[model samples]
Target: MLWVKAFHILFVVSWFSGLFYLPRIFVNLALEKESVSRERLLLMARKLYRFMMMLSVPAVLLGAWLLWLQYGGSGSFKMPGWMHAKLTLVILAIGYSHACGAILKKFERGANTRSHTWYRWFNEVPVLMLLAIIILVVVKPF
Candidate 1:
């Protein structure tokens, strides 16, 4: 259980790093025309998305497993209101990550060119999600 928590924290950090950078890749892709540079941007986006799928998903799963072990239907573990808020933030974060992944798949398939406006709005999603996650972890509002 201790090992699980340790790895969870480490991989969560890595996952957040990928999430933070994935949007920047989208922003870059939006700015460039559909040329060789666009291919490069797509490659970057795909790589980041792949990293998230491979790394972040497992990390999050392990976390949920640990939480279940600790708190799921167990009188030994009690969850407070603040922890519930944190769990909500985590779910949102996971959703945002999946959305980014979908966008990356579209980019990889050479789908419609995204406008800067689109990228900018999408970029805010991760940032806002990150802020929520941070608050959930640190402030832990009840």
Candidate 2:
């Protein structure tokens, strides 16, 4: 169980690394006017998104396993309010990641309409989610 928790944390950190940087890439993509530079940023963003998927899968699976280990009732876990809130943030984070993919696709199509300022603001969502999640996990203040 401790090992599972360790791995869960490990992968979560990995996922967050991509989550943090991909948006910075988007910011660069949004601001870049050179076609060659824009193409490069797009390639970087696509690869980072794929890496994020890889990290997220293991992070989520290990987290679920840890939850089961903590409260395995007929192979299911009954979570507390803190956990529920954390899960909600996790879901929102996933949605945000998916939305980033859609935005990336729009960039690929040369159809992105949002400004760099919009992307700079957009980049902050995961950071906020991460802070909330960490607080919930650590404090468990229900």
Candidate 3:
């Protein structure tokens, strides 16, 4: 279980590295006017998204494993309010990740209508999510 928790932390950190970076790429992508620069940014965004998604799979699986270990399965598990809130925030974070992928596609197709300002705000979503998640887990303030 200790090993599981450690690996979960490792993979979560890996996923977060992408969550922190890909949006900055979007900000640069939005600002880039040169074809060469745009193409490079697109390539970086695509690779980072793929790598981050790979990390997320392990993170999610390990996290679920920990949860199951903590609470057991099915009706045996009783969730605290803090855990519920943490999960809701996690769902929001996943939605944001999907939104980033969609936005990345729009950038790739040169169909982006959003300004760099939009992406700058968009970049803050994960930061807020991370903060809330950490607080929920550490404080468990229900």
Candidate 4:
């Protein structure tokens, strides 16, 4: 169970690495306004997004399972305030991911230029979310 938790953390970290970087790439892609560069950036964003989807969802599920294990997988699992906050942030992170997917679909339809400002703003979303997640996980700040 500890091993599973460790692996979940590893995957989460890896997924977050992509999450932090991909939006910056999207920003660059939006700024470039060049066909070739945009194509490359879009390709990179798509690939990184796919990797994040493959990694983070299962990692989150495993983390949830580990939380369940803390209470022996029964309804007796008492969550701290910070854990609840962390869960809210996790759900928000998932929402941001869905937003990214929507942006990707727009990109696929050549609507990328219209979403430049939103993409730039999206670049900052994960940083704050990651901060909250780290605080919740480490300091358990309620």
Candidate 5:
């Protein structure tokens, strides 16, 4: 269980690293005016999005594993309110990741219409999610 917990933490952190940076790349992509630079930024965003997907899969699976263990592998245990809240945030984070992919697709198709400032604000979402998740896990605030 400890090993699973450790790896869950590892994968979550790894996944969040990409979540934190990918939007910053979007900000640059929004700001870039030169065709060459735009293409470069798009390439970076594509690769990072793929890598984020890779990290997120294991993070989510390991999280589900932890939840299963919490249930004593029999769905007989009662989870605290905080765990439910954390799961909500996790789902939102996954949605946010998918949103990023959609935004990347828009950028790829030359259909992006948002400003760099918008993306800058978007970049803070994962930071806030991370904070809330950590608080829920550590403080277990119900």
Candidate 6:
């Protein structure tokens, strides 16, 4: 269990590093006017998005494993309310990742209509989610 918990933290941190930076890439992509630079940013975004997704798989699976080990077997779940909240945020984080993918697709198709300002604000979403998740897990504020 401790090993699982350690790896879960490792993968979550790895995944969040990409989450934190990918939108910064979007901000640059949005502001880039040169075709060459735009293509370069797009390439970076594609590769990062793929890498983020890969990291997310293990993070999420390990998280689920921790939950199962903690709350499984007896089939009587007495999970804390904070855990429920954490799971909700985790789901939202996953959705945010997919949303980034969709945005990347839009950028690829030359259909991005948003400004860099929009992406800058979008970049903050994960930060806030991370904060709330940490609070829920650590503080367990219920």
Candidate ranking (lDDT, best to worst): 6, 5, 3, 2, 4, 1
Give the deviation of candidate 1 from the true structure as CA RMSD: 2.4
- The lDDT of each candidate is 0.80, 0.90, 0.91, 0.82, 0.95, 0.97
lDDT of 2 by residue, 17-107 (tens): 8989998999998889999989889999999999998899999899888777777855566778999999899899888888889988999
Per-residue lDDT of model 4, residues 53-79, tens digit only: 888888788887888787646778777
Q: Model 2: runs farther than 4 Å from truth?
A: 74-76
lDDT score at residue 12, model 5, on the 0-100 scale: 97
After superposition, which runs of candidate 3 have C-alpha atoms over 4 Å from their true positions?
73-75
What digit string (tens of lDDT, one per residue) describes model 1 on residues 1-142? 8988888888888888888889888888777876899988887788788887688777789888788877885666788787777778788888888989888877777685778788778777767766776777688676
Per-model TM-score, in order, reads: 0.82, 0.95, 0.96, 0.88, 0.97, 0.98
Off by over 4 Å in 5: 72-74
TM-score of structure candidate 4: 0.88
Pairs that clash in candidate 3: none
Among all windows of 10 consecutive residues in model 3, the one with the lowest summed lDDT is 70-79
Backbone clash total, candidate 1 = 0
Candidate 5 lDDT, 27-132, residue by residue in tens: 9999998999999899999999999999999999998888888775775878889998998999999999999999999999999999999999999999999999
- At residue 123, candidate 3 shows an lDDT of 90
Clashing pairs in 5: none
Q: Highest lDDT: which candidate? A: 6
Instruction: Give the distance in Å from residue 25's predicted Cα in candidate 1 to where it truly belongs.
Output: 0.8
Q: In order, how many clashes per candidate? A: 0, 0, 0, 0, 0, 0
Higher-ranked by lDDT: 4 or 6:
6
For residues 103-124, write the lDDT of model 6, one tens digit per residue: 9999999999999999999999
